[model samples]
Target: MRLMGLDYGDKTIGVAISDELGWTAQGVETIRRTNRKADMKRLGELIREHQVEEIVVGLPKNMNGTIGPRGELSMEFAEQLQNTFKLPVHLWDERLTSIAAERTLLEADVSRKKRKQVIDKMAAMLILQGYMDSKKRR
Candidate 1:
């Protein structure tokens, strides 16, 4: 079954999709946040287009492993997605995934402007790949 991954942020939501075999994920696009209706609409379109069967949303937690406001928001978003799409949604611990993505961009010498544009998308890929890797180990 195909899966979709998301890094939900304040301004944008990064999207990634798994391969048919569910082994790898690739960055798809970044959806700029507008409003709830609009955001869900776009996500739904991508879901349909990609024929996604499941969703994995990154859940940002504090260093102490406590769920903070951001984590709460991610949980709510995941619930909404599950309700709206009627697909299973899983929240993957996403602490520092963004930081890792930033470091990777810096190592690649990506320009600041470009890095800002794609950081979320890259993070989503990391989150999805991590989840898929965990599943593989099982």
Candidate 2:
């Protein structure tokens, strides 16, 4: 079984896939959002290609652990994914994931343009990694 992770945003959806053992998550690609049908079609293709059995979506919650508008959007996306794919979709807290991704990129001296191109994918990787790490802790 394989797991997929998504960092859903207004402009793009960052995609990540776990290894066969579910130990590591690797950034796949960033999907630029056009419309729901197109977006889902692309996602379906990835799911099929990866043989993904489960999905984890990043939910951007407030520092207080309260779901905000962004988190609500992620929740709706996750629900839609569950209904459309008939696969279990989990929401993982994504507070500061993007910030962390940016910090890492900056520390590596990534050009601003390059960082812009890959930040979402990096964030998705972090989100998935965090979720997998939490599972390992249990």
Q: Provide the TM-score for each candidate, comma-separated.
A: 0.98, 0.98
**Can you give the lDDT of residue 76 in candidate 1?**
99
Per-residue lDDT, model 2, residue 22, is 95
Q: Which stretches of candidate 2 lie over 4 Å from their true place?
A: none
Go through the candidates in order and give the C-alpha RMSD of each one to the true structure.
Answer: 0.6, 0.6
lDDT of 1 by residue, 39-118 (tens): 99999999999999999999999999999999999999999999999999999999999999999999999999999999
Clashing pairs in 2: none
Report the Cα lDDT for residue 76, model 2: 98
Model 1 residue 64 CA deviation (Å) reads: 1.1
